[model samples]
Target chain A: MKAVTAFAPATVANVSCGFDILGFAIGDMGDRVKVSLSDQPGLRVVSITGDGGRLPLEAEKNTCTVAIQAFLDRLNANQGLDISLMKGLPLGSGMGSSAASAAAALMAVNELMGTPFTKTELVPFAMEAERVACGAAHADNVAPSILGGFVLIRDYAPLDIVKLPVPEGLYTTLIHPHIELRTADSRSVLRRQISLQDAVVQSGNIAGLISALYTSDLKLLGRSLKDVIAEPYRALLIPGFYELREAIQKAGALGSGISGSGPTLFVLSESREIAAAVAKVSEEVYAKIGLGVDVSVAEVNPIGAYVIESV
Target chain B: MKAVTAFAPATVANVSCGFDILGFAIGDMGDRVKVSLSDQPGLRVVSITGDGGRLPLEAEKNTCTVAIQAFLDRLNANQGLDISLMKGLPLGSGMGSSAASAAAALMAVNELMGTPFTKTELVPFAMEAERVACGAAHADNVAPSILGGFVLIRDYAPLDIVKLPVPEGLYTTLIHPHIELRTADSRSVLRRQISLQDAVVQSGNIAGLISALYTSDLKLLGRSLKDVIAEPYRALLIPGFYELREAIQKAGALGSGISGSGPTLFVLSESREIAAAVAKVSEEVYAKIGLGVDVSVAEVNPIGAYVIESV
Candidate 1:
């Protein structure tokens, strides 16, 4: 098969109630991976760019090549592939950058082949690759990266993941400060177990947020998007986290929360105007702390893991 | 200013994962309460029927009348009134029978008093009345009875509840065994402060269920409905609980679980035909178990508490 380049969007995992089980893909901010079938029987990593000399170029250590090899191994077919990683998304930025690379590489290689697996079936393989990068097999990022839109990782074993429909007019404002925090380091700050009372409250909030999402009741969504478990512990890492959230809420954003693992925050709004308003407030809040940030006003991209280019 | 009669549908609290936070109203099974603005100096409970003589006749002890008093208190005005409870739904049937009475009374009185409170404000009053009956403040039954569809009780204080759009084409099959289980008796069976591990699993299941409901994935909904916390202990109260669930599942119901506190098993199906089929299987299962049962197969009654008779 000819060479193909694909893009997998950045995902917001641990979406309040979903924990490691839910994710949604961003339509605009993501990474691209290029894959081509090789005549040789050994997988090879071609190059890695746009990562500021941080990512490893070794085929085994690299997330993209490891994901591609896992995809090939799943089919019991020994096929060589040349993989290139163009990391448009920042690494360790809490925007699901690593997961997007892993998902994109696996998807690109699968498409270059005859497509031997279903989208649902391929998630585990992609998640395995994510584990190589993050030391955990979590589907929140991989599911949305591969399937697109809102996804629920219903089960890890026997791999039941669901891609739910995003409500109409759904837009997101993503604010990323120029700060890096490893997913492992960020996860280490969390308590191994929370109190049952707190868990119940968190679970209720999560369930309520999802119910609001389905019903398209923006007010309820805003009210229910509270995170009693992860947010309280993790918010200390980002400067002006509380102020930014307050500003976002004041600007009429339905809800705002930490994006995945950290310097990035996401606000789900009903329109570009509201998103822009949220972005403005968020930028102002961050600027007060003397931080430069990139804010992307994007929509929930329904179509995930698509071919970006072919050569 | 005049007399009005209203009915609110029965509901199931602890909707699988929601424990005490979610509920939906049944269209056909409910209690009718009539309220009349009278020239009398104090509220009067004139009659109670269809309750097997188990309910209290005193206005202070009755669930419906307590709801009426709460409604009156919210207005900060004391008014004399006459209330009659037409106990259409069976009492102590684990089908939110008491909640229906409380909700019905609130609806009837609200309309009778010229609509001073919105449905959102009315839930706490209804829940308060339910507390008088069940010994705790719970909104699962009251919220749905008042709002008419699937309700996620995000918060009880200041009364934040989210009404989710019921998945389209959904139908319900309920099997009410001749046996009765009191809400108080069921409450005594629970252990306070469950393990944190168990709570996490339960919360995860609840989140999955909410996602499934939103996505309208019947299979996911069925799979996600497994309750690890309350159902295991309560299932022993219902005869043929596991067996009936199996039979109904085989007979085309997506899933079946103990409704509210006991004696009643509810099934969710995609279509009316499937719902009927599941109901038949449920009836057969109960019959083979040598138990008398009443099977009611109905679609989700979208309309909630409303005035059934005008003055």
Candidate 2:
């Protein structure tokens, strides 16, 4: 094959109760990467679009290219490649934008290279790009984006992960407020320590939340959505974050919390009617505050990243 | 019906990953409380046995009587009750001795009163007893003792709880070292606060553990049995505790940690053979330390407190 095109979906990490450990892939909105073979002996970025020229055109500096470079190094392949980036996800939007790019590029390269890897085998490669995105080796976003559905990154030392169940009919409402909050800056606002009581409560919620997912008990999951550690500290950076959370709760959201870092509020509901109502509430909350917002309703994506075709 | 007898199974609370919210009922080793009508107008303890005369016997001071009193108050029942306490579980042994007594007493009293309360409805009453047992009103022990199997206390504000699925073939190995470490004393050794990193890691483990239970992933569950909060402080109180944990891990146990507070070490294995091996490790550790040990292997008890017979 001379060329391959692949798409990777967006994901919601943290999910209220699980700050750094839990996330689920969501929506059709994602990034598409196009790869073509070249006579040259090294990878090159031909052009990048849909990101307003903000992303790097250099292969070494870009997130997707970083993942592709890692993949090539892992396989010891020396084929030259030309790449095009179509950024469907917003930058610093807390929507796993970097993860999508990295995942998509990795998928396209793997397809162009005759599919030497499974979908899950590409996570570490994409994480090399995620490290560049957030300056942390966290896999909450990349895991779900690569593996699909829900994922729990149990521990990072050995890269331990477990794929959690996602109940049917569950809908996610993402209200991305047009604001800037870098993942690094949002993370910097958190405390280095927390009260033991807070830790216990957070631990209970994570357990309860995971249990609810397996059993399809939405009410218990909603009640267990409290984040006693991160949300309390990071909510300050997102204007009206608390108000939107409360409004969504009243509007029938199962649970509501910040998506990844901030500026985007994620609400979960069982039905699209309630999810649409939740989206309306978030839109009104941001509109009242004079901030533009993009609202979306998504079900859990059963598949993470995939190839479109090869020619 | 004038007389009733009930048995409440012993429980291993904390369960490693779940500090304040998780526990499971064990084998037939438990407490038996026999209740009968008395001429006295108020609840009273007619006799006490099998505790080596160490536990409080006063109706007001006893954990079982406290639960009975609460059950009566909740139901507005004015009947007087005479209670006999048969302490099959040890006092201050981290085997949920107080909870077994409380659960047994509540079950006997409820049965004597025509079974007005459900097993779960008796948790708060048992928790009242728990407050007298330890200075804390936590229900990690009482919930499992009442509801059976594995129970997760999702929250305590409204007393939300869920019964977790225990995979078939899961076995529990417990060794109670002949030592005394009161729940209050063991609890006092913990720090009032914890670092955020520890909290995050602990939360991940709890989530992973619950996921493992639902999915029957033994290796994942074993890896998830970590306690960064209580075990560190409480391990100092249990002689050879760390060595037993290490030994059990080497003996093919899935996971091992403190049972509830201290003075008892618990290990989980997938079969009776492996559990027997784990128990051998525990017995050897305690015996080498010149301390008497009582070790037992148990399947996950599917029932907690129950009526022994109909009157």
Candidate 3:
């Protein structure tokens, strides 16, 4: 066996109405990882860069290395591998930085070892990798980062996942404010028990969003994708949440919501032009709020993890 | 113009997991309403029947009559309608008997008056009629009864609705127990608030159901169409809820749940034979539990609410 390296883009989970179940892949922001066969009998993470010296280099704590180890263990392969992660996206920025690294590592390792695991099989392992950092098993980020486009994790039990068709002309505007809110912290603020009435409303909203996605109606998609349960409670943690939303709405975003946990807000639009417009609008709003932010307009990347430049 | 009568089948709301937003029209159980131009101007409901003498004859209290009256009032016409309703499905009882009557009456009168309103416009009016019964404006039952097929009500503000494609080879078995549970009485048993955690799980299930339905995967449909929020709370009112579900599962129902509110249960299957098998199994179970129940196997009536003979 020889060495292999791959890259997987960052992802945005929840997608406004589909919290914990739905996600989309973003092409522009991601992480890169390299994996090489090692003579040693156990896995080892060699190095990591571009993560502000935040991510651990330990085998168990590093998301990329942990995910690769789990994937190899699942395959019952005793082979060891050395991994190097170049994290383009930052940690704790709610941009799925950990998920990207995990996906890249899993893909690189899987490919190097005769490609034993399918993308679906790699998802849970990747989520496990994410859990090393976030302290929980969740697939909203990993599913899209692995499968690409929009992915729905129907059930985790038998591992049922369904990929919904991307609505035509869908573009995204992502604004990452230079603030950090960990997924664990955001999750802790949520109430454990909610009113049954509120659950009914939230369920209705979810059904609407799924239907709108299938029907390809942008207007309905905007109207349907509402998070009465999570956004209200978590929005306070993000600075200028209301103003950014208002600006996005005014700039012709079909809909806008917090991207995953706080610090990153996303706007879904129909075209690159509108997406660019939204990016400009978001920049202005962040400026008004006295927060520095990075904005990008990316299409829904249909292809997930793959070797962009094969060695 | 001569007086005309119209009939609309009753609908089951919630349909197990899809609370406040999903419904389907059922034949052989519903309401019959007669509408005619009245001499005394404005709308007046003259008679009512088949309701065990529980329904009021006054226009203000009658749901079917109120829908027609609202339609006429919107037109600002001096003309009025005289309505006579023959209700077959019990009021509330989880079956949308009142919604059917309201939808049917409004439909028939609209035809007689040259259809002053579209089907979309008629939905809210029918929902308004439902409000007269349940004290809340909801459109799950009325939308299906009016537009037919499985309906996805995206949003109520702009009245965005999508008619989802009913999967092929789908059959249903409905078991109506000879017990009555009014919508008001059943709704009163529910708690006002719910946990956000439960909401996320239920939303995931609903998304799975939509995907399963679209893909025509019956097994996935069976697995995904689960109600975690409302079923556990409301199942207590239905006799033999446990035994009946178990029996149907044994008999080969893809899935089963409380029909709308209570006292009625619905089973989904792949074929009529399977549906009949499920019905037979449920009948024995209900009989053993000392609940007299009527069971019927029917395909999902894709064409909703049309004239049986001629227009």
On lDDT, the candidate that comes out on top is 2
- Stretches off by above 4 angstroms in model 1 are A115-118, A177-182, A270-297, B76-79, B114-121, B176-185, B188-204, B211-216, B236-240, B270-296
- How does residue A229 of candidate 1 score in lDDT? 70
- The candidate scoring highest on DockQ is 2
Query: What is the C-alpha lDDT profile of model 3 across B214-262, one tens digit per residue?
Result: 7777887898878887788778888788887888888888887777777
Best by TM-score: 2
A291 Cα displacement, candidate 1 (Å): 6.0
What residue pairs clash in candidate 1, if any at all?
none
Q: List TM-scores for all candidates, in order.
A: 0.89, 0.97, 0.94
Q: Please, what are the lDDT tens digits per residue for candidate 2 over residues B140-251?
A: 9999998898899988999998999888899998888888887678888999889988998999999989998899888888999999998988999988877888899899
User: Compared with the true structure, what per-residue lDDT tens digits does model 1 show for residues B254-275?
Assistant: 7767788877878888899999
* True C-alpha contacts between chains kept, each model in order: 0.40, 0.94, 0.80
Q: lDDT scores for all predictions?
A: 0.80, 0.89, 0.80
TM-score of chain B for predicted candidate 3: 0.92
DockQ of each: 0.41, 0.90, 0.68
